[model samples]
Target chain A: GELARAQPVSTPEVEAFLDTLKWDKNGLVVAIAQNVDTGAILMQGFANRDAISATIASRRATFFSRSRSQLWTKGETSHNFIHVQDISIDCDRDSIVYLGQPDGPTCHTGAETCYYTSVPMDEPKLLASTLYALEELIARRKTEEIAPGAKPSWTRRLQQDPKLLCSKIREEASELCQTVEASEGMERTVSEMADLLYHSMVLLSVQNVKLEEVTTELRKRFGQSGIEEKSKRPPKPTAG
Target chain B: GELARAQPVSTPEVEAFLDTLKWDKNGLVVAIAQNVDTGAILMQGFANRDAISATIASRRATFFSRSRSQLWTKGETSHNFIHVQDISIDCDRDSIVYLGQPDGPTCHTGAETCYYTSVPMDEPKLLASTLYALEELIARRKTEEIAPGAKPSWTRRLQQDPKLLCSKIREEASELCQTVEASEGMERTVSEMADLLYHSMVLLSVQNVKLEEVTTELRKRFGQSGIEEKSKRPPKPTAG
Candidate 1:
């Protein structure tokens, strides 16, 4: 007679799970603090590998305390715990990204991240990048490296004749003036104007004018009444 | 009478499409600034709305100023214009979200947002929402508000037998201990611990223990050395 056999279980049962489990020293583990808002890594600290362990076990956020030199639960004091949704390490595995919903602001000063000032990107990075691209294209054109294609690259065409870039700048400026006259949806106007300005920047770069130079000149004109600045400028003598 | 075949006719094409648009007097419009990372609305201000119009026309982010009152093109000086990817206005059409990549930090103070304080969230707001949800659930349990064909809620059961909540708390704490003993991925431990802490808070709320009272008591223990604090506590006296 064939006897009915019980199906063999694949996953570990709860009792067996307990036997396989090990112990954490304290409810603490090391945690690296990061800015949730700006995507900037702020500071690093430890949670009781056990506290952190507990946090993960509990599905709440916890961290180790370096100041007390012990495992202390987050939100225990401030009632604010960094909820952990997911964590992943980098290629080298030295750091981690603790991604989750932050209970409140992170920085002790209450700012988003620590590094606020960014002088490195003084000019718009896009404008700078575009300008660099134009310059490189111009240099390539001079060396006969400009490729012929169905869709003519603006830069390649401009490289063939520098005057074309200048004319485009003038055209863009005049177009901007016309757009200003019919003022609705400043959004579109601003967008088109940016294109004009970026193209203008390319022309300027071709002529060796840096963004800083323009900014310096604009700064000199700042804080002065527009009328006052205009009055101080040398006149065109009314063009006869 | 038949119309004569007309020669190819061309309507006027402006040099720049934006130049055809017009703006209002004072050349200013409202630019609503918000924290790019955290979706918090910060203070709003006017841009010469025209200078910004010009900046926008130039494909750069610009703002109108009311004080010096000229259009302040963002990144004009700092070279950090909020790069324009897309722009949308609110229902009333007074404010806007300049949804683009901010080249660098937006705040003048070098912090992320203008509001940098994480003061204790006012209690009234807390009570009306989160606290209210907890209270309503507890009250339902107390009333034994079981619906047709519904699994009994832990809260409802706890309300029926108040001592059971305490027992569960003790049980979870012991389970947490076992998880911690196994030094391993502490994440699971934290998740379980959060449940314990949250449940503990519910019990405290049910028992009329104010959170502030607990916080005040904890504050007293803050600067004391862990060793000193732990040593002073008497160990459980053994029963004869």
Candidate 2:
């Protein structure tokens, strides 16, 4: 039960640990909050000694706002708290990480994380979680209302016209297959595949399905070949 | 052809853009480098005016080393240069992002990115690119020579015993399927899936197969159903 609680802030051990930290000239250290379950970095900010102490005492992630020049606990306003489970300092002791469980979306923009924005490049790029990003964008588009006399975006048009969306999906998928059958170059193959993925994601969003559900289904099939083999084997004897 | 070259650094346009940046008290701003192709963040550091100018002029990602009190281009020593394609500033104008193509692994430790380590947690966790990380770890283990009398790791044992590895993969896959058949909770399903993914990754490493190859194959299958429908359609009229 004690392990479930935050480490006592008044302890001598914590005091010594804090003493070892190498704070910058402004008496602040870079602090990163990582989702304990997903291993995604939710956000990064600066923290002072008081902020760190407040985090430990309250079991909530707290940061020192540079402009405000004061400590503010995350989710104090949004109620999307990152519940700190543990705090760790980097090897160099100049930076810290708060391993925590977020109650809701951590970003102010309502994206999963603040680091979603990628540096602009000319070539098409795929983020590690591009599918997830696409899903989020599509979901946002689905919920957004169009104003009077406003033109509907391509995504909005797809969301409104179910038949058109379905046809587009089929069209993109067929194109993707043609790329493979024609022995098209890697770039064409990737481009077609991306189109298929995008259209498929939009369809999923229309159906109120999450991308995670699809990934989970794929994960299930990863072990499908072994199921038959497992069934053929004699069941292991269980002890009473 | 013009798109291949970096924007001229001496232009008044570049000067005006730089003027809008909100540098910190020390005349430094946060800089992040992202892989142009993969969309992975390579690393982050602080940059001064000189560092930004040097980066734009040289078409390389450069940062100000606070400890060294000088500007240094990434991969200057390692030769794994991040060739800048473009630079972008955040909406706040307080941070900069360099979109670049890296020559090799960006991290000094040989991992693809510096953001590999997830903050420690008691429960199991999975990163967005856990498979890639596992592949990298397995590859490292494959190459590293064991010190005299040092005990071999579990991964080393798997690498040494091909049959054992195969059996383990099958076993994990069966267990994963069992989680589904037995109506196990979501946690169990996710855990088993993670196990299967890990073992599969290890197998891929042993066989010299990359995870990207597997994903590409899956991408091909995303269009498989449409191939049949496309085959039934009449040929398009040839254009004059």
Candidate 3:
């Protein structure tokens, strides 16, 4: 999920950016391509300055194919084009990363990413934690203003009206409770809870509160007396 | 994201189910563990009758360790237990699948799933296609009478009150439109649209409309003139 900050740079700026990279003897740099929206590692390839230039110029991810011994414009044959969003380089400058939005699957095998194959849990933390993936996106959007054009995300907009967010949470929670208490609609309960989870994440995002904090509190109560744990909490203040 | 239907199975049933499995000469069967909630494959291991018995008895996934030459209760060392929900045998009965909810990461290497490494184009059809997953789940819930105990899904309940669902959709759509028109909040528009998407999915589910059908219609209009496409569709009935 790690990538570089992207900003539009001109021809000379692009050239200057490339000059900063420490290329290998093959005149290629290991490139990691990550999905722009989902924050998933879509694929990885190698790139030379020429390929980078073509990629920047064409706004498609272009790579120098080591096997083919030439510039390979991705999607040239597959048409699964990776529209380049930003290009970033590692601190060492030996490796480069391309952040892009793919029109289709990135893996030639039809997978979303090149590294879709689990490699003995080489990087377990990076596994697509599907349900909360959107939550993280919203969190990032709230914090980093990652989306270009100064676009405000839904998380940002909801932060403007905490009352609206809270009301939605309460409504969704009540609905979820009703569904569950009725026990006559498991799927509905799940669906209702999903809505609640989304709204709850929005609240957490707005408050800049991490999920792990709640998880930590939960963990603390794992073997302790619930009443004892609750006894230590700060007293609830009257509503302002 | 394939898994078994996880309903709390019983002892004799578990025994009968295990009996149906065709074990290897070493009395082993490959057991694949899957997350019941997200439908993500968690891990795979071998299990013998004892392991299965222990798993069923303890309500935790237990596996046979070939190298260790003994029964290995998952999360024994790591505390990342897979709380067994259901066990299903393959059609061939040579393999057993354990659908469970993990207390933590499933893979010893710290991954959510052992098969997290995706193989190249191994399964091309499932490269996300995100929007309709909920629709399919809702559809399944609506038709199959899933989640034993004869639960009428919230989708079903909402369908009974079509006007309520319609109003929710209309409210969400209007809010989404207002957010976009106001242009002061991009995130609000996204959140609003999310609400609309959820409501729309509910409508589709109740009507038993598959997302692919809608997609097919959209695809048909890809290159056609919008005005022409609109004209070709059946005329709308007059509003009541």
lDDT of each: 0.38, 0.60, 0.54
Task: Give the C-alpha miss distance for residue B192 in model 1, angstroms.
Answer: 1.8
lDDT of 3 by residue, B137-209 (tens): 4555455554666545455555556556655654554454455335536445445445555556666555444
Alpha-carbon shift of residue B125 in model 3 (angstroms): 32
Scanning candidate 3 chain B in windows of ten residues, the lowest lDDT window is: B119-128
Candidate 1 local lDDT, B1-240, one digit each (tens) = 012111121223312322332333544334434322222222234444344344344545566555564446556665655654333332223333343345666656654333332212112111111222234444545556568977565554543443555455444433333333343234444443433433444454454443323322322222122212433444223111
What's the best-to-worst order under DockQ? 2, 3, 1
Residue A156 lDDT, candidate 2, scale 0-100: 66
lDDT of 2 by residue, B1-240 (tens): 223222235556556667878888889887767654444556778888778877777778888888888777888788888987667655456667676678888877787766565443433333333334345666776778989987565666666765555555545544544544455655665555454455555555565655554444433333243322332454333211
| lDDT of model 2 at position B229 | 38
- Could you tell me how far off, in angstroms, the CA of residue A216 lies in candidate 2 after the best superposition? 9.5
- List the candidate 2 regions with Cα displacement exceeding 4 Å: A1-13, A34-42, A53-60, A83-92, A97-101, A115-240, B1-8, B34-42, B53-59, B83-91, B97-203, B206-240
Q: Cα lDDT for residue A227, model 2?
A: 27
List, residue by residue over A153-240, the lDDT tens digit for candidate 1. 4544543444455445444433433333343344434443443434444443344443323322322222122312332343222110
Candidate 3's residue-wise lDDT over A94-202, tens digit each?
5555555688888667776554432121112213433333455556656564456554444555566665655565465446445533543544644554555555656
User: Per-residue lDDT for A144-212 in model 2, tens only?
Assistant: 888998765566677777656655654554454444345565566556545555655566666565545
Give the chain A TM-score for each candidate: 0.36, 0.52, 0.52
Candidate 1: give its CA RMSD in angstroms.
33.7
- Residue pairs with colliding backbones in model 3 are A42-A113, A109-B121, A116-B118, A117-B117, A117-B118, A118-B117, A118-B118, A153-B187, A154-B187
